[model samples]
Target: MPLPHRVSDLSAFDLLLSVAELGSIGAAARAHAITQPTASARLSGLERGLGIALLDRTARGSRLTRDGALVADWARTAVGAAAALDVGITSLRRTRESRVPVAASLTVAEYLLPHWLAALRPSAEGASVALTTGNSDDVAAAVLAGEARLGFVEGPDVPAGLTAATVGRDTLTVIVRPGHRWARRRSGITADELAATALVSRERGSGTRRALERALRRGTDRPLEEPLLELSSTTAIKAAVAEGVGPAVLSSLAVAAELAAGTLIRVPVVALDLTRELRVVHPAGQALTGTPRTLAAIARRSASLDDPAG
Candidate 1:
């Protein structure tokens, strides 16, 4: 089947995106090592092809008009799709390739994976890694659907169709506003008290929720306080907790800065290991013992995941 346009034609799409981001055609052109005339002509050609005016070329510089911003959005999407396709094709040509496709739950993906990927040099694996971020369940789905070769889940048990290994550990700390009553109560706070008070929480399928469930199950049958607000990201949960909304149980990694700066205070929660082991899960049919093995080893080696509760 014929593609909508040749891949090279998307250079104009990329030019539009770069100009939007850089906020000037000359600056964007220089970023791509192209002359001003070439950039201007490229933008004009793209606008002509798409049958719309995409930019307001100014004497000082260029800026996106109303239509330009909309075109910029589509062009950005096209550029990303083009890049993904390019990487996929390049990996195919490699004899012993390591196109380390991964889908990881939010915490691991947002806070940790980039560091791990940077630590992995092209010398050893001679492979490339591409990451997709999602919640625990979505990460599992991506792996099961063959969209990712490996999955890292932070929330719950590994979903079926994938075998998992304990690669690392994360600490879930109890935290509240710096001036909260729990601030004086160091790491051994009781679940009875935790249950009595309102706390911010993640949605049902969060890995944090799974760990919290296990912790609560072992404690007194007292109905713990329901969530004051259910949020998705650790950032949101911590922000709410800091605002005196409620105390929350969250990854120490999530609140390290706040704890250090006194934006939030770490309250002592005892007897329960709020720590969860992070695992690398992959499909049963695919022999994933290759890149994940190397990637996991690198992750473990450089990981600075030593939480006090862990």
Candidate 2:
């Protein structure tokens, strides 16, 4: 069977996947190390060649239209295959041993994995690693799909179909600009108060956002209030909160530096247990071995070192 001419260029399919992931052509372009105009042109060309509109552009950002969503889903398979090929080719070209590929949540990838990797390297005689970053849900999916040998996630609940063990714990800290009213309050804000406010938030499906919503919805059936701004990146959220756009809940690991520098102040939430487990997960019923087992041991050791009880 002849393949569609529109997808003959794998890079164009990659850009569409990036657009779906990043929620904007500009952001996707930046991620791909291309100009916005280039990304726009590629997307336009893809749509024209496919004879279907794939994206709906708005002032806020671009989103997949109905047909676009289906295309993006199909594109994901192609991109995944390409990624596997890239990894394989790189491994073949390398003289040294192949690196273990791990998928991790943004919080873990940004703040924790580097330290763990460093700790693992010397002990494993200079082991190498390839890390992929995504939301917890995405990370879980990667592990389950065999795209990664291991995965780390920070959500309140473990994703189904993956076997998981709690490797560590982290708390969600509510942060606001120094000048925000919450920073000056003597009392911590209540769950009810938090639910009533429209604040900066991670995008839906993010573990950080899910943990926050779970805390807010406890003891009541009320729905969460819409966010003042929904950003896919934690860096964006921090920048928005630092500018006093609104209060936001983020991983304490993510905000420690900002808190110490006084650029962002922590606002305690009364009656909220925002603590969540950091988990290491792999495919269900699969026994850990090789690099995956080694990495997991290092992670657990690091977790123990951070905890006084260990």
lDDT scores in order: 0.80, 0.85
**Against the true structure, candidate 1 has what lDDT?**
0.80
- CA shift of 247, model 1, Å: 0.8
Clash counts per candidate, in order, are 4, 0
1-310: candidate 1 lDDT, tens digit per residue: 7657523587888888889889899999999999989999988887887788888877887889899898777668778988999998877766345576788888888778888777776644567877888778888899999888788888658777888877688888888897888887755588777767777998888888778777777776887777788888888888888788888988887788788888998877666667788887888766756666677777767766779433
| Candidate 1: residue 252 lDDT (0-100) | 80
TM-score of each: 0.65, 0.66
Give the best candidate by TM-score.
Answer: 2
Lowest lDDT 10-mer window, candidate 2?
301-310
Error of 2 at 66 (Å): 75
Backbone clash total, candidate 2: 0
Candidate 1: RMSD over Cα atoms?
18.2
TM-score of model number 1:
0.65
